[model samples]
Target chain A: MTHRVAVRPSGVELEVLDGEDVFTAAGRLGYRWPTVCGGKGTCRTCFVQVEEGAENCSPVGPLEREGIEALRRPVDGLTRLACRLRVEGPVTVTKRGVRRRVQE
Target chain B: MMDETSEPATARCPGPSVQDYLDQDSRPVPPALRYERNDYLGSEDIDTARFTSREWAEREMRQVWRRVWQFACLESEIPEVGDHEVYEIGDDSLIVVRTAPDEIRAYVNVCLHRGRKLRTGGGNVSEFRCSFHGFTWNLDGTMQTPPCAWDFPHVTPEKFALPEAQVATWRGFVFINMDPYAESFDSYRGTFDDYYIWPLENRYKSLHIAKVLPCNWKVAQDAFIESFHVIATHPQMLTWLADANSQYDVMADQPNWNRMINIQGAPSPHVADSVTEEDVLETFYDSRSFYSAAQGRDLVMQEGDELPAIPPGGTARQVLAARMREQLAATSQQDFSQTPDTELLDAINYLLFPNFNPWGGAKSNIIYRFRPNGLDPDSCTAEIIFMSSPKQPGETPPPAKIRWVPEDTLFADIPELGVLGPVFDQDCENLPYVQQGLKAMRKPGITLANYQESRIRHFNQTLDQWMSR
Candidate 1:
């Protein structure tokens, strides 16, 4: 089963499969997401503000929490690490200020 | 600002912090982890002719360049079968290719038919087809097709197989030797296993930068072999690097190999009298914090922040290293948890033969290779490769394409170089000046310090030995 993930502002919708992370889902649909840590949840560069449907994403893992704390990036309860957020149902999110640098 | 006797100051720690954490089973470093060294090198006048004279360079191309085992490319660079890299030295270019799942082959990159250069750069190809004449050879250099078969009645496929060179691998580095009867690579590279047995194969090349330097290859290579120049050339490092006190150990039994173990998190012995515990703390905190920030980690310190307190019973170096290990464990899935403080903080730099300098470590481990720009006495190709341990088993990072920076380009333009850019920029600035000085100086030779520049002396002796052959 696939759930619709609507990226706000861009209004791009991606059909995220079960157990697929939001970052991977977005990447499949030609949406660029920063993956500095190669999606290990170590680098907080892959964060996205979940505008709605937090229930669709997986509960924040230990690594995700540690990343958020370590990076000192304040995230509201709705903010989800795109690399860590496994899509469960329909969701809406906006990409945070993160883009892959050409050199990196 | 108060008088010395009035207040009780926080006592700085001594020795390594992680030493206390080690139990009986894992405290002692095994024999495999150690490298042998001999510090017996006599001071000798290194002839300036080797650097400035084209005649010497010509002789070196035939004798030294062909004879010595030189780094061709990384095995990771051509991971797929049929992928090849054209490694050129002097007038010779060898196509180092992966022919099978496990086997790698190297052949002179010249077409047998018309002697046209088969390939210029690196790429994957099922067979090497000459652009000039369409003469083709299999990945293993067996002649596959001669365009218009009737044109070459005298040439048979069996007899026209491309000539091959001796190829060997250490860790992930592919080395090639052109000499028909070169010594067994094991015997030739006796120092490599003993010194860098640190699972270097587990690391993947993440960055590569090459630039043409206006200096002899030997001069560019020699600049990096010793830390003594850090005092004069990189004076800012005087606050951290133990330049004078740094141990320069040479394996006199081994040819053209030496290791310089520079003590980091300490001031240079040149200014030992002025060094204080606070200076050590500041250096450790600043360098570690800066390194963390460069790696996409949040700043461990802020502007005007107080230096981290040295842990009890630990020196500043150990404290910083221990914290770094913790940070690494927390940030990355790669388990460096087993690596001891001694190996983690060890700032040992090894110079292997003609030109390969690699420091021991996972992160911040930089490898340098210098080569003559195809027999140019006044110019050399300086390559810098940055590597880190693979995050997963059998994981290979993408082969970083060599970014050749123009001489006029600012070092600041390449932010991926991290802190190394400024340090290398300084060396690049001095290389041309040194080259010009070598030509203009009335002195027939260069004099090296007896103890400090022993690596340079050892290297010269090895070069002389190779050149004699």
Candidate 2:
């Protein structure tokens, strides 16, 4: 089942398929996700908050939890790394820099 | 934890970083390995005069060079009484000598007679006899005689003895401080010892290659302090070394040193998505081939050993580190089974203030010492020494002789350097132009990356602290 991710403010929607994280899906759906380490989840620039349906996202893995605690991000406990985020249903998230890729 | 909530300086965070690997490591990592703090050095352009000016060089000799502890030479370099080596910094030189079985001393290398240098280089000698005149000093720095003592009443033993510098030894390194009132070398070194798992004293110098580069000492020193240059300067390393995600740290308790830990066996963050674990292993094998050959040991890939397969869900680093641990355990006397994979495989480098770098323990046995090539501010000597573990357990290998690579000789041409040669050459290619650019640039100061090149900035801040006085 394909999960829809509605990036807030910009409202760019991504069809994240099974095993595809939002960051990878963003690439396939022709949107540019700001990232320094690509989809490795090393660079925290690609983090986002699950504004709606936090329960729909996969459980936070150890590396992602470590990243959250180490970086001390998310005033709330709802932040998930877009690169590591997997969802089963439609979810709404807030990220400032997600935008459609400009065709060359 | 870094207290990142209260610390605005460390706001730039990296995930899946060196810490993730450390968290997975079986062995407990030290605070030194886990430590993270950045004393926010404000954005400022560094004056070019710090590198290109003659007066700037003279001031460093008087202020910073005189005040800090200097790594003169290894204690093993002067193992016996009367054995000495002359170390020169800027305009000053000192004779670092082994006075007795348990004592080492450093004295002004100048002759009291007419201010001529007493020793030109390193050698084993009974006493220091001034070459220009017949003035002599005993191994302990006591005035022995003046050729015409009766004619020279001013040459008294107490007054004419060479002025001694404060001396201290840590591990196998003999360090000297010209300022008699400077802090103890122990305090100066601080908790820097917390990082070294493989004691440097247990290793012996196996290769020494000093190359004169056309750049300021700091310019040459900065090149090795960060992994930021790896993606551009050492592209081949990206296959197995994680550069951008490498940990860059400055301990608040110890500002005198900064650390960088580059995890190998992982693709660099820059090329993460494109590379596979199998590619990482193949490249890793090629990288160690030369150093393995130089040591007369093919531990990484012996004659017909097949490439170890990286199991699904496993990492190349884990596989390679396991191979190294098993090899070292069987071939040497040390217990390596519990050694952390990071210590076994990563580039765990630390730079002490001024210019002393202990790269890491275990298989990566590299140490770097950078100095101004005598009084010249624009040129500096960069020395690379491989201090390896004993091939025969308890046997300390003979100290390798220094081989100065001519300024024009590419490091790759040097046989002893093995694979490190080309890497050094690639760095050397940019330094001369960098020096020239700094001189001719319109900008008054050099700009630096806040996180990646923070070590260089921290070094400059420390240099400013020393020179401020």
Candidate 3:
């Protein structure tokens, strides 16, 4: 199973395998997502807008909740943490313009 | 409930009592009165040339940075056991490693036997053994095994442990002190707690970008301290991102830290007073109005009033600026007069002395670490990390891709430049030149103009004070 994730502004798209976290999936597709905790769900830079297939993603956890509140990001179901979210099916993601490109 | 076992006993250790360290006579040397050297250069003197020289930089490392609490890296950089990262400050090299679950250690990077560098780069290991002679040291810097323990019968592994530096962590940032007698990290950050309201511990690392430069560490640091040069040095950034000559304020009263606030549209461009309530409503309304107008969406105005006329000089930039001004104004209307409603502030840049600066705005926040290149006086390296909040739980972390824009590329084409790296490069391009110019000065001394860049003067004064003592 695979999902299609598209980054906005740059309009780059990639196919990610199912069960992969959004960050890693993005990485597999040659897209870099920002993750500070090295994918432990801590830095909160991997936010993306789920334009489609929101129900196919994993549920949020305590760590992700704490990170969102600390960063004061808008709390809506549409936005999800890429580090915490694992893909269940096909989905599309939109990256925020202001966020920095992931540093290798 | 607080986990007693997980927390270090010193975690709750009381900070130095007011009488013990802050009593008028007993206070640590004041940053203002300590160094009175006339040879120091002001902020304007910062440029690339000064960074490349190896000799002049060594003097600064000995005199200034050796006394400061330098950030090693983020704790998450070495999250798992045996994970490691090597950091070089001035001529000194130190390694930070996770030796055990929930335990991290730092040590001078040199080997115990022949004094060769222990590890080439970062990696996981149960023990770090020097490849040259197989001198083995545990992750905690304890000497574990000598190549031939029986041959050197008199030598004790326990007695030859690697030296440890004073290390501490606050909000996930690892800081180390080379001087054994240096004050505690909390004391070093004193009175600046209010400025670091971000939940840094809760925050994780998103990206880490480093660049080796040819200028002094101070030149790299001073670039972030003030916005005064944005107009001339970064014309594109100033046009789109900031208004030069904004009102500026500096918290000189604090020790080992400085807090500066810059208000938009203010004359000094360095600080600003708190925003007011009317500002927020107007900004929100204007943003909605202009965005609607540009997209040709229907204007949802109050029944009695036509959509408020777009104000004069209202470019999209002005509209965006108005929105920020309004948000800050609304936040100021709240009863918390003592603290700025960080939520609404368009931009806030915090400078941690010696060499750390963290800046945040409505968009994202970034952390910068500057270090001297291996005890060299003229060259340095800077590390930059950009971060943002996660949108929801269970969502995957953001991708770590960065679009590397070459020096010749215009700033507008680079999306991330406004957020971190490019802006830093703008500062970097000039530092090496400044370093070179400083060395060329026949007299080798430069005077600071009081009104233009007082922060630089203040920094040098503080540096001299700390180094002399």
Q: Which stretches of candidate 2 lie over 4 Å from their true place?
A: A1-104, B1-8, B11-15, B296-299
lDDT of 2 by residue, B387-458 (tens): 877767789878998998988788888766766788889988989989999999988899777778878888
Interface CA RMSD, all predictions = 18.9, 27.2, 13.0
**Segments in model 1 whose C-alpha atoms lie over 4 Å from true places:** A1-104, B1-36, B287-306, B311-314, B392-394
Q: What is the full ranking by DockQ, best candidate first? A: 3, 1, 2
Judged by whole-model lDDT over C-alpha atoms, candidate 2 comes out at 0.81
For candidate 2, give the lDDT of residue B377.
84
What tens-digit string does per-residue lDDT give for candidate 3 at B1-469?
A: 2234332212211322212211222113233222111221223433333345555466667766666787877776777897788877656788888877777778898887888888766656556666566677777788865766777777687778888778888877788887888889888887666555665554445555566666767777777777667776765443232334322234455535553433322212221133223343344343333221211111223446543344554333233344444433342232212222222233456667777777644323567777676766666666666654434323335324323334354433433333233455577778878777777766545644433355565566666577556
lDDT of 3 by residue, A1-104 (tens): 67766667567766667677777766665555665335655446677787888787787665566557655776554678887777767667777542334667
Q: In TM-score terms, which candidate is top?
A: 2
- Where in model 3 is the C-alpha error above 4 Å? A1-104, B1-56, B237-244, B247-253, B264-345, B393-415, B418-425, B441-444
lDDT of candidate model 3 versus the reference: 0.56
Estimated TM-score for each candidate:
0.74, 0.77, 0.59
CAPRI verdict (incorrect, acceptable, medium, high) for model 1: incorrect
Give the local distance difference test score of model 1.
0.73
Candidate 1 lDDT over residue span B74-173, tens digit each: 9998888987899999999999999998989999999888899987778776677675666778787889656678888888999989999999998888
Residue B118 displacement (Å), model 3: 1.8
